[model samples]
Target: MSQSLDIAVIGATGTVGETLVQILEERDFPVANLHLLASSESAGQSVPFRGKNVRVREVDEFDFAKVQLAFFAAGPAVTLSFAPRATAAGCAVIDLSGALPVPQVVPEANPGILSGLGKPVQVGSPSASATALAVALAPLKGLLEIRQVSLTACLAMSSQGREAVSELARQTAELLNMRPLEPRVFDRQVAFNLLAQVGKPDAQGHVPLEKRLVNELRELLEAPLLKISVTCVQAPVFFGDSYSVSLQAAADVDLQAVNEALEAAAGIELVDADDYPTAVGDAVGQDVVYVGRVRHGVDDPAQLNLWLTTDNVRKGAALNAVQLAELLIKDPL
Candidate 1:
């Protein structure tokens, strides 16, 4: 922990990348030199670090050998293209984008996975929804024999990036002023309407996000054969992703134990039944997942239902990757 290491943040100009920089400063990661990298278009932009605005350089031109650790917080294309070069240069990589088929890690759920990784370590952070779900459910895993999980993830526009967030705002303003609305970032009007699917469905009628949830959640929970049914709905919100989850347990449900488990778990804030949580009210700009509305299904003691929310950009993507780095540096990176 005393040794300082050079680190690089890919896609530093983007939302998740910027948040990663902020969290690294906030958590005081043992960093030596901090390199901020972006695409050609985003290069020359500056991201505020500890006490200075660090000018971001183009990722393609930067040498990966300069840093001991690198965080790939950009899109899949960026991670897919540059991560191998980083690993080839002996730099440890923690990717937030789903490009790499490496291990999907949530520190709270599977911190032990890092120790078993191979040399020139490579790991992936789960999607925002899966990260929140793993934080909520991992604690209860030992107490309940979960058979399957059903979830409807209400994603905010920010999950799609800054443009989606702006489009939501513009569409809302035009609607309020009774002006003609033209959808640009989204295929249709997302303001005051729920999008049934996030992207085009494959032959099996499941979108990519849904597949990501299933695969990543299973990995995080260490349940390779676990059954999961998820529907990623685009909610007309600006930030935070919410989930309506139902877990089918093998035995009769225990409400008190479930509540206590959530209450004592790390990276989770359990709300009382008196009032439920909303994305804007509870989760936005926060670091932990907010869980409420915990109860058993009507006339079905084996079914447990809950509501969860978290900041998709911060806690879900950036912070999760940063946390993996913290654990990875525990020994040597």
Candidate 2:
């Protein structure tokens, strides 16, 4: 049997944080004690875990030295403020907020990066879109050297957090009732409409989400020279993320071999050509990336296309954080 350790989950009331707590129990991670910490506004709330209620304590009041591992699912500001403190207190941290200036880890793609780390170091989890993209491209890395990658990611409002989810629900209802649309969580209407940009545009015109996907993919693939371009769109749905990827390989590739490679890849479920996965219909609550609609360019056999989807909250954020923690525990690096 695995030995139990003390664990603390920051931002216990947020969407990803809540999911992390649930996954810890679902995956049967050995735990001697579980601590839930949140901001003062959310503190005192009870979160269910292992058939009991665990009250959340204010993060400012919690002592990081008490826990062996800390999972930060809070936003960037919160993570930045507390992660360093936790690390200094000798607590290993797996940050899902993408704010930590640490090694960004996707366990399935680069578990080795964590093996050499010192104890109590902070590890950043890649963005949801980046995580899905990295997992999809991992199998194709050596099979056919990729020259460039272009992708369009359709993200749901849930990726923004629980408030965004609630805003989407509110806007959707108002629209159905023929009321004026109120856009708060998002810059524009997200009810039965799609936003071309997911975040504020940069000087070069690329949104923050798009920039993150490109940068993180290159990092996770360990291919600094690899060229990647991405467009992030906010879909009207409430959960899951979908991607349409176009890969330009350096050499001719066989369709059969590509399909076989994806089939054998970890944390991926390749669907049949005749069937495809939708975020709402197939990806929600699932733990693996669902891939289908694979086809090679007719004019250029070196080019390939694919459609991928996964639960943004599950495999994208919460599960990946938990898996990273598991890896750190097993290796204690």
Candidate 3:
């Protein structure tokens, strides 16, 4: 007998939300009913779900009493206002915001951690860390205790949000048409530029998103003391994320064995130089993590350097949320 579950996607019109819908349809999740919720401005609009149209509802009017699972992607504000109510109503909330203060999930990188949560696990981590976690951890699984990691991410405009995606498209059209460029949704022109930050500034100038990555990565890896240094930059690319990870681990780690482990791991792909080696765009729409340029650290042979990429929207955010939902369905609470 097939199980029936009512699935609700909050923020269904946003970038991650839209991508989640596409993935859910592509993967054919066992959704008995699909509910799309967004702000009032987007409410009443229709979105495709399982080949049929599902009308978007206003978040304020959403009823969670009969919802078996709710996928919250709107933001922390909405999640805080509604998540508890949904949970109290017997709905398991899978939040995409950092608000719930729980699992910072990268499903391919870490699965089963969301299990036994008794309710939803909020996903934190920036797009950078999500990609890094998926690729970097593949090689070291169970073999090396990663003590410290330093990562610099080359991110896409999509990380900023859907409005940024639109801004990029509008600016690109203007550029190709030889029109003057104006910027919004980004600090400056993003069509032919790179920005070093995302989200608001902290006292040290680190964005909230970047700080979340450090803490979330530590929690996800179960290495609470794991030291992480990160610098996130937004590139002109449309999708995907790329990173260079330098890790300090135990003594005399075998690069060959690490590479072998990554090559054989599920949901990961090893890219060779002859394959035209690396690019952020290469990760778009791909479900697997891509690893390249694996080498020993210059300072210490125990340390390792790796280049990683994944579809920022796929494995990084949307697909990861969907993967968690899938896991829940396959194995109930």
Q: Whose lDDT is greatest here? A: 1
lDDT of 2 at 91: 91
> Whole-model lDDT, candidate 2?
0.89
Q: Model 1: which ten-residue window has the lowest total lDDT?
A: 324-333
lDDT of 1 by residue, 1-333 (tens): 648999999989888999999999999998899999988999999999999999999999989999999999889999999999999999999998999989999999998999999989999998998899999999999999999999999999999999999999999999999999989999999999999899999999999999999999999999999999999999999999999999999999899999999999999999989989899999988999999999999999999999998999998999999889888888777
Summarize candidate 2's per-residue lDDT along 1-333 as a digit string, tens digits. 347889999999998999999999999998889999998999999999999999999999889989888999888898999988999899989988878878888988887899767777778899999898888888888798999998989998888888888998999889999999868978788888888887779899998788877888899999987888888988888999999999999888788998999999999999999999999899999899999999988798999999999999999999998888787777553
Query: For each candidate, what TM-score against the reference?
Result: 0.99, 0.97, 0.91
Ranking by lDDT: 1, 2, 3
Work out how many backbone clashes candidate 2 has.
Answer: 0
lDDT per model vs. reference: 0.94, 0.89, 0.76
Question: After TM-score superposition, what is the CA distance of residue 217 in candidate 2 from its true location, in Å?
Answer: 0.9
lDDT of 2 at 48: 98
- After superposition, the stretches of candidate 2 with alpha carbons farther than 4 Å from their true spots are none
True-structure RMSD, every candidate: 0.8, 1.3, 2.4
TM-score of 1: 0.99
Worst 10 residues of 2 by lDDT: 324-333
Q: Compared with the true structure, what per-residue lDDT tens digits does model 3 show for residues 1-333?
A: 238778889889888888899998998888788889988888888888777888899988878876788888887898899888887778877778778865666665667676646544343433445545654684475777777888888787777787877888898899999988777777678787777877678899888877877777766676778788888888887777788788888776788888788878877887774552355556778887788888887867888888888777777888778877777676563
